[model samples]
Target: MSDVSNSSRTTRKPKGEGHSRRGEILTAAERIFVEHGYEGATIRKIADEVGLSSTALYMHFPDKGAILQEICRDAFSRLIAANAAVADEDAPPVRRLRRMIDGYVDFGFAHPNAYRLIYLTRPVEAREGAQDMARELGGGLFTTLEATVADAVTAGDLKGDPSVLAQAIWATAHGVVSLMITKPYFPWADRQTLVDTMLDAMFAGLPRP
Candidate 1:
């Protein structure tokens, strides 16, 4: 359900397609969620969209809520792995923080649908299981970022309250990804150049001890 209109959907895909109907369902659901909104999307509609019956869809995901939860869980798990690797590296705190920020941007472009579901969702629409990702996995991501910010502050390479700086950095990165995603039609600079310039400017302006 990640994107609504796919070639696979032209024919009703039987149960076995690459041994993982789960991916297709998720992709389809992403599109459905965007097109129909969460409440408007139902098991039957999602099933039809994915060329499966409601029963078949249930076999992959117990319900719509489960699908949303799995999307959130899978996304957070990937982000955590990427973040842990950067945070563990024996690099300058500022460098590690930059790399982590780059990785976050990379993730948003690489999996836009999952990114939207995990970050862009309105609280009420995402259901309780989905929000749990925020309380649990989402908190872990922020903690890692904040820890890195604290490290930089302690090293005198970055000047600001660690918590405040961490939030500001995350917000800026999110701004880049969200704006690019939601407004592709907008005229923008080359992505790499734009991101590099934005990062350079932000870090350069930050007061250092």
Candidate 2:
């Protein structure tokens, strides 16, 4: 037989290669899901995109739903971390609100796919399990925001009800980010311009001088 290289064929992957491979698969799946939506994405397509056979992919993820769950959980966990990192419990009310706003925007822009997957995708009954996980993942973040608003109310720095203020802030930031992502080409206004305008208007209307 002709001399041939066995080193290339016999080399073993690094110890963490398995986890890296799963991460790669998840990245590929997110791209496909964003481009094609839930129904259009398929395990076969994800496997092909990642240069894996379908059987190899299934070894990592039991099914497409499992992959989706993993992705959603990852995204939600990031949201919780991002919010918690900035919303200091002892900070002044206005400062906490500003930090929360900054954190929200940073997370959304940094992980556009994750933001869209969590905020924009329509819910399905079959995936209701992910909803519960989302609440669990995000409970801390919400609690942080709610507590800040409650503190502000108690200090008389803010006039509105805490829950209403919390909800309004969430809606305002989410609306701005969602519109920018989903309708970037819309002729209404520039993204930063609109976001800044909203922020300034929101602060301008806050309870005191």
Candidate 3:
């Protein structure tokens, strides 16, 4: 519940448990990446935050880049899986699209730290790391989204290039996530109400088929 972009020490987990230790490392690395950015987020920094030594961290991950990639892969993989489930629903494509969008926004709110680490880091190194991710999970995330958009177009419920629509829709959702996360001080409407209003307004703007 505290800020993920802070170097807060977590309670140290036991070393022998690989899964839990990996999770702790990831949780700590998320905070380190945001607090220090990619170039600054050293293995030592992450290890210290998670209560591990650099050598112990290496046993779990090769380097900070690997750590970053794993974090991004998990986040994007979960999102894509959630969207895939939405895609399978017997609802209308446009309505199913709304469900997918809802899942995306819910992720931002539920795991703001992971979201920020994936999308909002500012350093050049961080951006490059994100770009590299595009070849893997990041690319898959967009491809999945584009496929959903294309389905909507094919269903005769929306009119637009699938790629463009997908990008625009994603950018709009990202805007909501980034703004809400970065500008928590701003006076804003209720969270769900604002999200619903924004989504409704966006869906209304789509050219009807």
Candidate 4:
């Protein structure tokens, strides 16, 4: 009986260890990717960072692109979850829009490396359909924004075509977050102040209720 119990414990331990090791590899890979960019971050480098032999790293992830896809997929999933919460709220369109922007900015700040990996990295072909995953996730978020903008337009709380307005708003938010992430050395105001200023500028000419 004791032998069986020990065998069971040994079997469970590797499963837990595998998950923990995978997570460590991902964390190390993210740091390396951020510092070196995708092309420059080699498998050997990531393995070194995680204290794993390259062969062992490959046991967990098939290739570098697979690692990147997993990182990007996780990042987009979090963003989608955050936006989905705002989308489901029973609130006025204008209020919902504001909340969504706030959430977007906060997410970017909280996960700067992930944000940079998704937005700042130059496009490269991804294995495991990473591009499709990103497009599907991103499209859902954009649809929510467009719908909110359309709602605001219908209620006379804002003006302009919903599709165009959504893109414009997205561009403005992207610019603000991109600058915050890529130009951290620049002398800048408080993050909240910058966000408020950018949002104010974007909404300046739109009709408000």
Better of 2 and 4 by TM-score: 4
What is the C-alpha local distance difference test score of candidate 2? 0.72
Candidate 2 stretches greater than 4 Å from native:
1-16, 125-129, 188-190
All candidates: CA RMSD (Å):
2.1, 7.7, 2.3, 8.0
Quantify all predictions' global Cα lDDT against the true fold.
Answer: 0.84, 0.72, 0.83, 0.77
Q: Which 10 consecutive positions of candidate 1 have the poorest summed lDDT?
A: 10-19
- Against the true structure, candidate 3 reaches a TM-score of 0.90
User: Which tens-of-lDDT digit does each residue in 1-209 have in candidate 3?
Assistant: 22443446666676468888888888888877777678788999888887778998899998888888788778887888998899889988888898999999999998887898778766576655655765677777788778888988998889989999999999999999889987999998999999999999999998877
Segments of candidate 3 deviating more than 4 angstroms: 1-15
**Candidate 1 per-residue C-alpha lDDT over 115-206 given as tens digits, one digit per residue, 9 for 90 to 100:** 88888887888663667887799999999999999999999899889989999999999999999988999999999999998899878877
| Distance from true location, Cα of 74 in model 2, Å | 1.4
The estimated TM-scores of all candidates read 0.91, 0.83, 0.90, 0.85
Residue 31 in model 1: shift from native, Å?
A: 2.1
Candidate 1 or 3, higher lDDT?
Answer: 1
Off by over 4 Å in 1: 1-6, 10-19
What are the clash counts of all predictions, listed in order? 8, 0, 0, 0
- Candidate 2, residue 209: how far the Cα is off, in Å: 9.7
Off by over 4 Å in 4: 1-15, 125-130, 207-209
